[model samples]
Target: MKKLLIVSLGIIGVILVLSPWILILFGRNQLHDHDIPQQEQLVDDREKHLILAIFPHPDDEVTVSGTLMKLKEEGHEIQMVCLTRGEKGKSSGIEDEVELAKLRTVEMKNAAELIGADHLHLLDYPDSGLEKVGLDSLKKIVGELIAEVDPDVLISYDSKVGLYGHPDHRLTGRAVEEVFLEKRGMDGFTPQEMFQVTLCKKQIKIALKLSSSFQKNYPEDPKQGLPRPDFSINTRKFFPRTLQVMQAHQTQQEVLKDLMPFHDKVPTWIYSRIFDREYFREVK
Candidate 1:
């Protein structure tokens, strides 16, 4: 029995060691799984006045890609800031923190370009490890970007748990809120005073309720739900493009496989897609 136990343990250990590569090998399809010839929309304007997105990881950007793509196609000056390189993230299969960061940075840039936004900001902070970063450093880094972009509309994770409540996400919410309210009138700031920023509390709740309802009807599927959302953006038009952008994260194929189906099942006409909301206030 002891020998059998030993063999079992050895096999488990081998699986653990090889799991990352196996996931990567089989998951490579995720990277190239995009439907060819992205859908295009005919819109009136193609220049953004100013739109900015702040998120903790690469995929977070897609939470509101439909609105963003529309804005971009309409010619809104768009910019995105990814706080971390997602180095701590398990994707890309590279264990070296430095290399992983570099890889994700490239991946993010590629994703941003696909979205028609060339200005992508990478803070290069430690990934999934914001709890270890200096608060002062974080505030400053985020503040500088806010000042530079001075975006008319800002989107980010709800400081609350509307978007998975990751610590890094929370930090993004906190930092952006802090900077948006306090960094006004600072040098290099191009203020967009009338801009409306969107957040995801209500939509998350709606997604949750809807997900619960679906799960109840179809218990065979794993239960997943988001919180209710106040607003819903129809992203079906942008799914192909967004899917391509999200696929750039090479390591997040499984996540896509799991979530995309749910997202697709959502009604295209009334998908409860909500983003968190925090707007800038001029400094006193």
Candidate 2:
């Protein structure tokens, strides 16, 4: 029994020391298996660009926070647009919707600031009820903001998958695409590129197989595969700041726990080794 215990302890110690490297290998393998595209060559970092993000809720920005921080470091302006305050969900244990709204707004502002966002535009739309707002109405509201920002690049959730198949995410993505494609280069809205936040299909499959927490939780999506990412921004240097941006939304811990299960349990280096890059697909 003593010899068996000693051997088990040695094995555990080896795993503890090698886990980070193993995770890095796994991450690289996933990146390779998915055939993730390289960074776009035409994107000139020397020329300043206004990058705007549109999403349905406060914490949705988490998907792109690392990239935003990196861009800000590269002398680009970052703007975030949130369609709702995320008051409808009581995941925060706050029963009062009004109070929840107030808190979520503050959290979002702090998160945006931490992510180096220059502006955060808030639309007071009903949380979790975006479809009721009417597609045309949403297009008008989002169009007005696009005209005002005149962003060089616009980013939002993947229209086909919606980053776990959220209705609000899908709707906001649809609105942004329709509004921009219909009126580009006509009404002072000259955003040249549209990028959608996404995980490559292989990555999604791997994540789903590894974590039972996400099983049976996604809404039905007609799209057969997850959206493929065309660009990957290496945020390896800014992952610490990314954690801070994530923690800024304290009230949304429940939601984050599933997405980042090891964030708190593992050291930053280990966590960053696996999630060191943010993925996006540019709409052609």
Number of the top candidate by TM-score? 2
TM-scores for all candidates: the values are 0.62, 0.87
Clashes of 1: 32
Question: What are the lDDT figures for the candidates, one per model?
Answer: 0.57, 0.81
Q: How close is candidate 2 to the true structure, as a TM-score?
A: 0.87
Give the deviation of candidate 2 from the true structure as CA RMSD. 3.9
Question: Which segments of model 2 are wrong by more than 4 Å?
Answer: 1-19, 27-34, 40-42, 209-222
Candidate 1 local lDDT, 43-113, one digit each (tens): 22443467777887776676666667767866777788888788777644668877777777888888888
Across 212-237, the per-residue lDDT of candidate 2 in tens digits comes to 43355443453644577777877878
| lDDT of candidate model 2 versus the reference | 0.81
lDDT of 1 at 258: 38
How accurate locally is residue 121 in candidate 1, as Cα lDDT from 0 to 100?
A: 85
